[model samples]
Target: MANSTTAQALQNITGTIALVGAGKMGGALLTGWLDGGLDAKRVVVIEPAPSAEISALAAEGVALNPRQAATVDTLVIAVKPQSFRDTGAVVKPLVGASALVVSIMAGTTIASVREVFGGAVVRAMPNTPAAIGRGITVAVADDNVSAAQRATADALLRATGSVEWVDDEGLMDAVTAVSGSGPAYIFLLAEELARAGVAAGLPEALSAKLARETVAGAGELLHRSELPASTLRQNVTSPGGTTAAALAVLMGENGLQQIMTRAIAAATARSKELAK
Candidate 1:
């Protein structure tokens, strides 16, 4: 969980909040808000088919799509890119001119959001780890966004995890390729590591246990350490050690670096394509 600073920052959203999607990321943000002491009565979620978690939230006093549309102080849109075209108009009327509009949809630019729903538009990229309050989000705000509104958006995003503000929205695609999609990449690595361990004669269960723990432990170490990742990697490698032997193959010319670069590039291109 993020500290009280984030919770305190969220207090500025004292009016009404309208969240347009109650799926994973949206649900995670909503959960974080409620856990942080935001008044449940002040929030309204616009979900077509409510999940059990959403039903529970509604029971807790967070409004689940009241019939009459009311103006909100903050409008948060977390719908899929394709669904935006169909749902955007319905949500536009719910926002007041002074309200803050933050979109967590990937590949949806601030200009695009502003075109559909006019307000202080912010574009954010948040990863799935947000469900557990460990995600990292990068956000960019349009010129229409005020300093106060930007801070409000920052507070909302930080409820889920760390928040980074970027001056250039164009860099969001790179952010998407790295952090937004990076968790899946790490999970794939863990899977392959376990398989390789099994191939080396270790039992399947033992291999899986070793792989999961190694990756989890390394991530925790990295999180706690002030040292750069490269420095930490060097610290783990002894002269002619097993780690060094593994690094030789991984650091080879046509190796992890090249593979990662190509992967990010492909992801960035697809993100650009989606914007079109």
Candidate 2:
């Protein structure tokens, strides 16, 4: 469920909202809006292959691919980056002249969005965790976006998780590398940790279970704790203890930090390339 501010913001939108895709991330956003008290009757979902879950939404009053496209107040583009052009051509007519366009498709630029749809655009990067409403999104809007439009975008994005805004769109590539792709890094960590546990003579199943639970529990702890991550690390590490020994290797000169820096730089570079 969305926070109070997000819920109120969703309830406040009186005009029609059209979601252009119903994949995992798009479906997540639709669920968030409804769960946050937005009226289902006001939404329109445009998807060529709607899942059973998405098809079910029509029963609740959401318009599912109406025979004709009508101008809408907000148009959310959540299609795959590679298919955006074709999808944009189909959905462009649904965007009113004064519509607010919010896109969650990574590597798609605000300039490209405006070129296709010609509305006040907000380009956002939201991670996979959004499916569970625990993601974090970073957004940047084009100059034409009004204060109200920006707020509405905020509320919509916040339905799935926390939101941060940036003045410079250039920062979006790095943001995409960090939080947008960060979950995969954590998942990889758990995967490698499980392998290490297996190498240490633990049963494969037990090692996998331990690694999964440890990563999940630690993430939850970080979520609930007010302390900085560094402080939390210190709290767990005692002098020459097991955790400290592991940290010594992970914190070494050619270790996780260096690897992660290079990884993010590569991802950022790829994002920039994709934007072009």
Candidate 3:
């Protein structure tokens, strides 16, 4: 992972950025790209629905729907999986042989994108927190992509938070389950933990606050620390303490590990099903 300074220093390279959708993930990327020194004039967003974000882009002089599709340096596909058939038709012209196509749609294969775009395709999956610059994106690209194109794609994606590259395309389903859909799982955990705390007699507001802050702070600590998660857990657990007691229940057989493994398996299978 690039440190904050390295990530910030990797900005300023410029090129035409055409986002074929203006949904949440696409809008977050557009925000990050602009923040990372990409000129609004060089950016084109094509969203027929034109949400408030698309309207804002229009006000900033970004082309909404152009008369003709022109070749772009980079094309970002952020439409939904169900929408790709239509999106493929709409975005084909902008994707010249040389353009690098980066897609953030989950379960959509790079081969599928190449079939439509006819270019160097990079499959990416970015989380929602990218809107606030705390997302992580995992990308994998075709071998035809040049080093510069890879770097450009990395920089564009890193603007959201951190970027990782995976070699095996099959692993993307697991990545999607772990990160793309992972945030919702964490959110659910926070909600359930808060409710459990409330049921255990803590004040409603206090339980909610504690649960949220605990998860957030733990996440931050994990991010900042170099130690492994197992070490961190060991460091926090004391013999016969509350944390230890909790772990006895949570870390027991058929506990968190088993539950989580099952959950991830289910999600991965669903991702494969969706791809089909």
- Candidate that would win on lDDT: 2
Provide the global lDDT of candidate 2 against the true structure. 0.93
**Candidate 2 lDDT score at position 184:** 97
TM-score, per-candidate, Cα-based: 0.97, 0.98, 0.93
Write one digit per residue (lDDT tens) for candidate 1, span 122-148: 899999999999999999999889988
Candidate 2's C-alpha runs over 4 A off are none
- Model 1 Cα shift for residue 179 (angstroms): 0.5
Candidate scoring better on TM-score of 2 and 3: 2
Candidate 1 lDDT score at position 260: 98
Report the number of the highest-TM-score candidate: 2
Clashes of each: 0, 0, 0
- Count of backbone collisions within predicted model 1: 0
Better of 1 and 3 by lDDT: 1
After best superposition, candidate 3 residue 77: deviation in angstroms? 0.3
Candidate 2 backbone collisions, by pair = none
Model 3 C-alpha lDDT per residue in residues 1-276, reported as the tens digit of each score: 334553454455556678888888888888777666566787888888878756877677687774434768788888888888787787787777888889898888888888878888888989988988899899998989888889888988888898899888899999988999999999999999999999999999999999999999999999899999999999999999999999999999999999999999999999998872
Displacement of residue 154 (Cα, Å) in model 1 is: 0.6
